[model samples]
Structures are given as C-alpha cells and as structure tokens.
Target: MLRKFSSLILIILFFTTNLFAQEKPEVQIGGALRFNYNLSSWKEGQKTRGGDFGYDVFRVNAKAKYKGVKLNAEYRLYSEGFGGGMLKQGWVGYDFSPENNLQIGLTQVPFGITQYNSHNWFFGINYYVGLEDDHDMGIKYTHNDENWMYAIAFFKNAEELRFGSASDVSDSRYSYDVSSSADGLYRNKEVNQVNLKVARKFASGNSKHMLGVSAQYGGLYNLDTEKTGDSYAIAAHYELNAGNFNLKVQATKYKMNPENPADQDSEGLAMTAYGAPYLVASEATTYTIGPAYSVPVEWGPISNLQFYNDFGYMNKANDMYEDSFMNTTGVLVTAGNVYTYVDLAQGKDHPWVGPAWTNGLAAGTPDAEWETRFNINIGYYF
Candidate 1:
C-alpha cells in the first residue's frame, strides 16, 4: 500500500512538472466524497426483514488543458461500497476535435448501456452493466459532437492477463461440472465489443428534458464454443424546478444470452472441468423503469443539503431475470426484493455470492442473467 501511494505521488508530480512546462496550464483538480446508509427490506416466505449499513466513497480527478487538447485522470478511494476497495480508474485521453477523441489505457468498456453514474439517485434500479472485472489495457476511439456518438475498441482480457501466457490460448476453469471456464486468470477466450449511443436535450418553459439510447455487442473471437452477450438501454430524464419540486425518470432494456445446460450443474462437480460443448445460441431480456424526486433544503444545518427519493420496478421476461444462488456460506439467497445484497453477476439470473466473499459458492455460471437489485440511499454532498 505504501508503495502504491508513493508511486501515485510520483506520477502526479511528473504530470504536474510537464503540465506547467507549457504556457497554457489549464490545470483543474476536483472530486467528491459521499457517505450513505441504506435500510434494506427483503421478501421471502411470508416474513419481511430489513438490514442497514453505510459506505463511504471518495473520488478525485485531475486534468490539464491546452486549447483543444485536454488530458484527464481520475481515481476513486472507496470504503465498503458495492464491494470494498481502494481500486481506482486511470486513463489518458486526448481530444483532437470537438466531435472526436481517442482514449487509451485502463477504462470501462462500452458494452453495457448504463453509464457509471456520478449523481445521488441511488434508491432506484440496478442495470446489467460492465464487462465482468475485465478492464482492457488497450485503446478506444470515440466520435461524438451533437446528437450521435459511436465507440469501438479492443481489450486485453483481464482474465487472460492474470493466467494465460501472452503468446498462447490456454484454457482455464472455475466452478463445478461447469465446463465453461471463462472466469480464470488466463482465460484465452477472445472478447471484443462495439457500441453506439445517441442523445438529445430539449428546453421548454422552466425545465430541461433529455433522451438517450445505447446499444452494445460482445463475443469471443477464437473459442469454438458459443458464448456471447449484449445489452440495449433507452432512457429519458427531465428536470423542472417549480418552487421546490424536482422530478426525473429513467428506464432500460437488457437483452442477454439464454441460460445453457453447461451453465448449471446440480451435481457437485470438481474444479478444473474444461473444454465442454455448448449450444450456439439463446436469449434473455429484462426491462426496468423508475422515477426520482428531490427538494433542496432551505433551513437550518440542512440549508445546503438536498433530500431525494428514487424508486423503480423491474420486469423479467423469463427465468433469466431471477437470481437463484447462495452466499459464500452455502446459504441460499433467493430472488426477489432483497436488500443489502448486490447481485454481482449481471450476466445471469442465477445468484453468485457478491464481492462480500462468502464460502461454498463458485463464480459466474456459464450463462446467467444479471440479477436484479433495487437499493435506496440518502446522502449529502458539498
């Protein structure tokens, strides 16, 4: 940890020295810290129970600008959020034109329709977004100006980097009887992605309304076995300040591959099972919608605070939407309205114990729907 901190300082120093080397030092640094507590209620049998806790998130961003050229770097220091972590984001980008730019290094893939949000609308729905824990160490090109934006990129599969040799395609495995080993350190599975996004905003009266659409495609390039996934999201959000009323709405649709037989094994199978046969295709789709309300505080110690509430409903089109898995301790965490637990596997309806790290559970079923999660959070930011 000490080494990491020292290295980070050195990197910042190097950038600062070089940044001031130029005359147009448009350097800017800013970030936010938010701590929130959530009270969860779950539905099981005929009883309803609740859970509570808190998490802190600290984020920072540093940027430098020179005319049309801009460079950005961001990091997040977190304490027990979705999964506890000091993990952060590090990327370097350059804007060659107002409509186009290229970024390389470590960054999120554009496969999932939902963007990692920066606001406090936490008490809503969770969308299936993200390429597992895979962060590509490659390049991404994006073109956007007004109403339309498109992105394409190739990534070094994070799994392959940790296990496989850079020169060869090695097969690795995780979980029982599960022939598909897409979750290994050196998973040689070929992964690639392409995405397109369109958005527009309109101003009327005293409010602003925005609409957005997102689409993504992903699959392996070399593996003979068939395993692929994709997502599509459409959302509309509006803001109107009438005295003290604020309102917004968000919705999404996620289409994923159907669950495969190889994905689930009732018999306790040992690890190291690999190179299993799989069907060519399957499909699962989910839809979710919700709204948000906020009122700015105008009194006492809460003068600068904003009170907000958000709610959503998710409809599963098939078995692909239910989360049926156990905690690390072999305790079954069934599907439906469970709070305090985040269904980490957004790819399948089956449950895989979350980052909380329980015993007795394996990772990522061959083909599972991302579990559905709804959470509410109250917080204050300055």
Candidate 2:
C-alpha cells in the first residue's frame, strides 16, 4: 500500500509540473526532520530515558491558481510504524467573490484553534479529546473579510484514510475500530459530523485581538457491540498580540454519552490523553493558557528566539478520578528555517505532560501521582 501511494504521489507531481510548466503555476516543497533527546523522572519505581532520531514529517505542497479557480494539495511521508505516504490534505476550490469560497476534500476540521493553540509541540489536553488539529474527510465553505471569518463543514468520516483494516476486531494500531472494548466514549470515529466556527478580529493600537467560538457534534455506532456513542463540544478562544508579546487562552466543555454504558469497564468512560493511556472520565472541562515573548537578535545563523510557557488544567466529572494538569516551559530558537526547542515539563495523569515511566499505567494506579521530563528537540524545515 505504501509503495502504491508513493508511486501515485510521484505521478501526480510529474504530471502537474510538466502539464502546467507553461502556465508557471506556483509550486513549493518543504518538510522537517526532528531529533529528540529525553530524560524522565517517575514518582515510583525506576526512571527511564531515551533518544530518537528520525524525520518527523516530509511533505510536498502544491498550489495553483488560474482565472478564479484554485487547487491545492499536500502529501506527507510518515516513518515506519506510523504509516507510509498518505494524503494529508487535498482540495479544489473556486472563488466566487473576494471574501467567500468553497472547498471540498480531506481537510482540517474547523474546531478549536486551527493552527494549534499551544506553545509546546505536544499541544494541550484538548488534543487528546479530538478537539485539536484533527482532520476529516469533508466539504467546507468559508467566508473571510477584514472583521469576521466563518467556516462550516460536514464530515463523512472523522479519520478513515489512514492505514487500517476494515475489521472491527483488528488490533493494528492503524485499525478503524471506533471504540475500545475495555472503555467507551473516547474516540474519533464519529461520522457525519457537523462542525462550525466563527471569529471576529479587533485591532487596538499596537495590539490585535481575535475572539472565536466553535462547536461540533457527531454520532458513532459500534457494529460489533450494537451500541451507539454521541459526542459534542462547545468552546471559546481568545488571542491577543501586543508588540513582541502574545497571549492565547481557550476554554472548552465537552461530553461523550454512550448508549450502552453497561458495556464499559469499571473505569467508566474512556477519554483520550496524550502520552497516557485512556483517561476514565464521564464529562470533562479543560482550559489552556499560553504566553510568549519573542526577541529578534542579529547573530550568525540565528535570526530570532522565543521564550514561552504553557499551562493546562482538566477537571473530570467523575469523583473517583482526580483532576489532571500540565505545565511546560520552553525556549524556541530559530536559525533560518530550523527551530530548536529546549523544554522542561511536569504533570500528573496525562501522557505528554508526564514522564515516560507513567505511560500505559492502568487506571486508578496509586503510583500515577506526578512525573517530570526534560527534552531537547531540533528540527530543520525546508
């Protein structure tokens, strides 16, 4: 499958370049390779550390505009075990007016913050709940002007394009199983999802502010268990940029309701958390705040640097489950198109926030109190 996909992409690129060479359509190719060295401290047992070097992403992006019609496509190559080559985004659209257009393809869902609302590479807790940086097979209509921006999309399948087997019982990491047999309510398998977002921008002196609201609702059905799942989220976000300093904040309330709650294990509802096993929670509310300061310095091979901090907190409705929170402080150094990150992170009960030792810990484990990690990541973009 990977070989076939790679061949297809090469063919597309070949045809696009040769066929449109005379037209002089815009074409750009770029990607990034990231290396990580990580150290962890666990609350119990032994501490662990490791290092990995690989290409984080290799993508080909092409865009062309002729007359009033526009076409865009992006293909990404994933390393072993993740998947092979896949279509990250591909769309064709036409501009009816200056401020309005329509696009159809496998694209990003209009929910939460579009470009990610976190300073850290791992993002915030909302990402685990399918509210961050999620893409779907859908058609979207967008309108943008000086003051207001609006988007609405209808998705047929949340994440069905990746490598996976059609069988429900397939345990392959890339399988299409919507819900885990051990837990219910935490999944991105919802179909026919309707997502919408609207935002307004305001400028004040040297500061620019953007405030937005987003909502999503979807339905899920498990053919194996003959059960159903319903998911929805309501969120508000605010961003402010003043001089070299910027601040971003978001709050979200979400719910996942299962038709046959009895099928769930003793842990109750399963919620997705980065780097951590499925979190057990009925309903959840989460908030994230990030502030960053950037400074431009003249130095050989270094153009700018940024210092930032990200804080996130999550509260679960179930009393049996304790609250979770994460804090990350990092410095991002940019030299030309390359970026380096030096970070120290600490948290409890969440995967990316905590040490590596706590990953895959069963629910209600006493040793899952707190963990810490220090990481250095170097990435070069082309």
Candidate 3:
C-alpha cells in the first residue's frame, strides 16, 4: 500500500509539474532541518540520558498559484522513522473571494488553536489528547473577515487512510485496537469525523484579543470486535497579545462513549501525539495555558530571545484515577536563519510527557506519579 501511495504521489508530481510548466505558474520551494538532544528521569526508579544527532525533519514544500486556484503539497523525511517518508500535507484550494476559500485533500483539521507556542517540542497536553496538529483526509470550507473567522470540515478518516488487514483485538479491552499490525494504518473502519471552529478577534489599545470555540465529533466501527464507538469534544480558547508579551488559554471537555462499556477499559481511544501514546479517557476535561515574553537583542550570532512556559492539566471524570498534568518551561533563541530551543519539562500520570512514555497502561496497571526531561532542539529554515 505504501509503495502504491508513493507511486501515486510521483505521478501527481510529474503531471502537475508538466501541466503547470506551460502556464508558467509561480513556484516556491522551502524546507527545514532540525535536531534534538534529550535527557530524562523516571519516577519508577529509572534514570536515562541519551543524545542523538540526525534530521528531526526534512520537508520539501511546493506551491503553485495560477489564477484563483492554488495547489500546495509537502513531503517530509524524518530521522525518527516515520515509514521512511510521509505526506505531511497536500491540498488544492480555490479562492472564491478574499475572505472565503474551499480546500480538499489531506489537510489539518480546523480545531483548537491552529499553532501552539511551546518552547518544548512536545507542546502542551492538548497534543496528547488529539487537539493539536491532527491531520485528516477531508474537505474544508473557510471564511475569514476582519473580525470573524469560521471553518468546517468533514473527514473520511480521522488520521490516515487505512487499507490493510483488520485490527488485532488482543488488547482491544485495554485500548483502541485500530490495526492488527503496527505498520498498518491507524484508523477505525467506517469512520466519519467533523470539525468546526469560529473565532472573533478584537483589538484593544496595544493588545489583540482572540476568542474562539471549536468542536469535533467522530463515529467509528471496530472491524475486529464488531463494536462501535463515538467521541466528541467542545473547547473554548482565548489569546491575548500585549506589547512583547503574549498569553493563551484554552479549556476542552471530551468524552468517548462506546456501544458496550464492557468491551473497552477506562481508557477510551488509543491516539498518538507526535508518535507518542495519548489515550483519550471515557470522560475528561483538559486545560492549557501559555505565556511568553520576547526580547529583541543584538549579540554575536543571536538576533532575538523569547522566554515561555506552558502548563496543562487533565481531570478525569473518575476521581479514582489520578489526574494527568504537565509543565514545560523553556527559551527560544533565534540566530539568523537558525532557531534553538532549550526546555525543561515535567509531568505526572501522563505517558507522552514522561521519560518512560508508553502507549497505555495495562488493564490493571497505574500510571507513574512523576517524570522529567530536558531537551534541546536546533533547526534551520530556508
């Protein structure tokens, strides 16, 4: 399947290039390279430190605009092993007006804050809960004006295009078993997802304020167990930019309801946040807040510096289980075309945020109380 997809991508690229060559469409190319070094400590009486140097991501983005129609695509290569290479985004859109447009193909879902401002590469807890950078194969319509912006999208699958064997049910009771093999696509059968968001921006003196509401709903059928499940979330977000300081806050409530509770454990859906396990609970409420201050400076090989902190907390409906939370503090330093991030992160009862990250706990196991990590990331964009 992957080979076929690769071939299809090549075909599209070849045809599009040839077709656009005659029209002399505007073309632009850009990419980024990043590296990471990390050290970690676990609450389970384990300490580990390791550093590896490689391409965190090597992306090639191509865009062409002819008349009111535009085509944009990005292909990425990762050192972390993401099936050798993957399509990060590929979409075509038409501008009906300056404020309205329609996009189709694989694109980011319109939900939550579009871009997260985290000094740490891991971002906030929302990323772990499928509220951050979640892409899907879908069509979306968007409208934007001076003060108001709105978007709605419909997705055939929530994450990837699954075209393989049925999922394994051995751990179905503990978490979502979307595919039988790890290499297979991670998605549910007969799934449909809808995402919508509306925002209003207001300017007050030197500060800009944005308030938004977002919602997502999805229904899936488990091919392996012949069972069905549904999930939904409602969120509100606010952002304020004053002078050189910026702040953002968001709260979301999500619920995963299964056809048969006995068929699944407390952990509702098995999701990933940047390749890390982010299990959505049966019912949970999460909150995230970030504040940042930027300082302009001129020094040797340094242009600017920003200090920021991100905090997140997730409270489960079942108090019997511990709450999940994370705190990250870091600084972003910019030098010419290169950027650097230094971060210190700590978390409790959160798998992805911890050093010993795991998909989900065993059916009867409990999460560790605490974990810590320090990370440094360097990236260059061109």
Candidate 4:
C-alpha cells in the first residue's frame, strides 16, 4: 500500500511539471517519510505488554502548487489501533505572499506549538511532544513576518477529533446518532465551540537567540452530558546558540478539567490547551528546560553527534480541592546523529525516559509511574 501511494504521487508530480509547468506557477512536491518505534521499559512495579515496539506513525505528505492555489494530501499509518489503522488529511491553500497564507480543508487544529513541530523524529529532545494531539478538520490562516506571526482557524464542530463519532457513543452510556449531512458538519451537537490563536516570534542573530509566545482558547458545549471541558493556555520557549553548545527553556500554564474527576464519576473527552497539552483538575501547568551540545563526527557515515538531557515538571495548581489531579514529572536523556546523503538527510533520536513521579504530588493514579521510552526514526525530507 505504501509503495503504491508513493508511486502515484511521483507519477503525478512528473506529469504535472512536464506538461503544465507553463500553465502553473510551480508545483513543488516534497515530504518526509518517518518510521518511529518506542522502547517501553517497565518501572519498579508496573508491567505492560502492548506499549512497546513497532512503528507509532508512518506518514507521507504530497503537495502541489499552481499560481496562488495549493493542494495538500497526507496519509498516516500507525502500528497500534489506538486511533484506527489509517487517516487522511487533505487541504487547499492560497498564498498571498511569503508572509501571508490561508488554507481550508481537512487539516489539524492549530492549537499547540509542539504539535506543529516537525515530525522528523530527530528534530527534538523530548520523547513525547505533549499530553494530547490537537488535530481536526478546519480552515486555517497563517501570517509570518520578522517579529510577528499568527494563525486563525475555523473548524467544523460536528466532526471534531475529540468526539470522533457521535452515533456510536461507545464510551458514554448515552447513545446518539450522527446526522449524515453537511449541515451536521458545522452544527455543534451539544455546545458550540470555536478556537482562537495568536503568536509572536523574536530573534536576535547577533546573540543567536530565539523566542516565542503563544496563547489560545478552546470552548466546549454540553458540559454535563457530553462532559467535554474547555481549555486555555499560554506558553513560551527560548533558544540560545553559541559555537557548538545550545541552551533552551520552555514553560506553559494551562487550565482544563481533570482527567478523572471524582465528582464527575464519568469518562468524558478532554480539552487540550494552546500547547495541545491536556488540561485537568480545573487546570494543569508545567515547565521544562534543557541544554545540548553537538560535535562534528569523523566516524563512518555520520556528520554530527548530539546529545541532551532535559526534565519536565507538571502539576495542578490553584482552585485546589479533592480533585483527582496529580503532579507528573519526567526526566530524559536523548542522543542522536545526522547522516547526509546525495539528495536527503536522515537522523535517529532516542531518549532514556524515567517514570512520571507523582509521589507527594497529588491525588491520582500511581500505577508504576516510571518507564523508559524510545523514539528513533529514519526520515528523508526533500
């Protein structure tokens, strides 16, 4: 199946460039192919069998541009059945300039900075990007300049990712059927919800400094029966580079419903904040920092070797009651290398992960709170 898709995309690109190059502004085609695997090590007491090995996400994206109009299609295959076998993302966009662009179709909700980070596997230090994945079908707009950038989106509340299927309320005791029409697409079955996001970027080349700030809000409806919670968050990240050494810092403050509320006593969908991190117990906030260094390698087929150690501490704060929220923290050590090829580059990154330490933190599940996680992948982005 993967081979077939790749071949089809190549064939389309070949014909479109040769036959329609004059008619079209340009059709540039490129994407990344990533194969990710996780190594899960049991904690002091916890034992789980299914959370180990195999590819987590296998995705391919293809894009075409003609004049100011652009088309994009992405397909993702997963090893686990957590989110189904295969999913597709297709969208159309119009680029007004290098700083202004707008796209509408079935794309992800722009709610998290980490979620937007490249999925090249070798790009970041953390094993996991965030608490939840924020993706949905929507129309998105983007603007980028020197010091400011923003994204505005409007999504269909009916086909929301959090509430995948309304007809088959498997998790909920209540049963409801989804409408089979376009009107159902925009209609918020329970509570009407929308998202608003804005961000700014600051950089100083002389000092090799980069910084960003972002905030967003996501509202939910039918808080009782649906039990869907709303969320808001603000986050910031900064990076500094000097010679071969690098330093980075990141922090986020988010508020949302608890993952497991004692009073609620029900299983409901969670609302993710601006950083795409799950909000719980009225709210959950976290902060993280790390430093890394890279050294040019003279070994076989390796360009540079890099390593970093980072730690994250997350907990519930404010409006504290007898809620089922707890503080979770993780320590990580990641190392990887870069390999350059004729027309592509590949790299592998993995982290020695520690368990989520929750002792003396708060009230919540404490099932063997520790485990080792591995994330390694080979990717080619053109």
Candidate 2 lDDT tens digits, 1-382: 9999999999999999887666545555566666766666753332432543445556677776765567787776655544556666677788889899888776777887767778776666666556777666778898989899899999886445343542232222221223443332333345678989999999999999999999988866544455657778899999889999989899998776655435444333333221123443546788999999999988999888899999888777666666677788998999998899888887777655564322221233445666677778788877
Clashing pairs in 4: 191-221, 257-280, 257-281, 258-281, 355-370
Measured by lDDT, the strongest candidate is 3
Candidate 4 residue runs with Cα over 4 Å from true position: 1-22, 25-39, 43-56, 108-133, 158-165, 168-205, 223-229, 241-248, 257-282, 318-363, 366-369, 378-382
Looking at model 3, the pairs that clash are 167-179, 167-180
Against the true structure, whose TM-score is highest? 3
Compute the lDDT of residue 224 as modeled in candidate 2. 42
Task: Provide the global lDDT of candidate 2 against the true structure.
Answer: 0.67
Residue 250 accuracy (lDDT) in model 1: 45
Candidate 1 C-alpha error for residue 201, in Å: 3.4
Score candidate 4 by lDDT.
0.44
Which runs in model 1 stand beyond 4 Å of their true positions? Answer: 1-21, 32-55, 66-69, 79-88, 108-124, 128-190, 220-251, 258-283, 300-309, 317-382
Collision pairs in model 2: 275-351, 276-351
Q: State the lDDT at 251 in candidate 3.
A: 93
Span of 10 residues, lowest total lDDT, candidate 4: 171-180
Candidate 1, 59-152: lDDT as tens digits: 6777776755666656555543232332234567788777788777665554323343212332222321222112444567777654455666
| Local accuracy by lDDT, each model | 0.38, 0.67, 0.70, 0.44
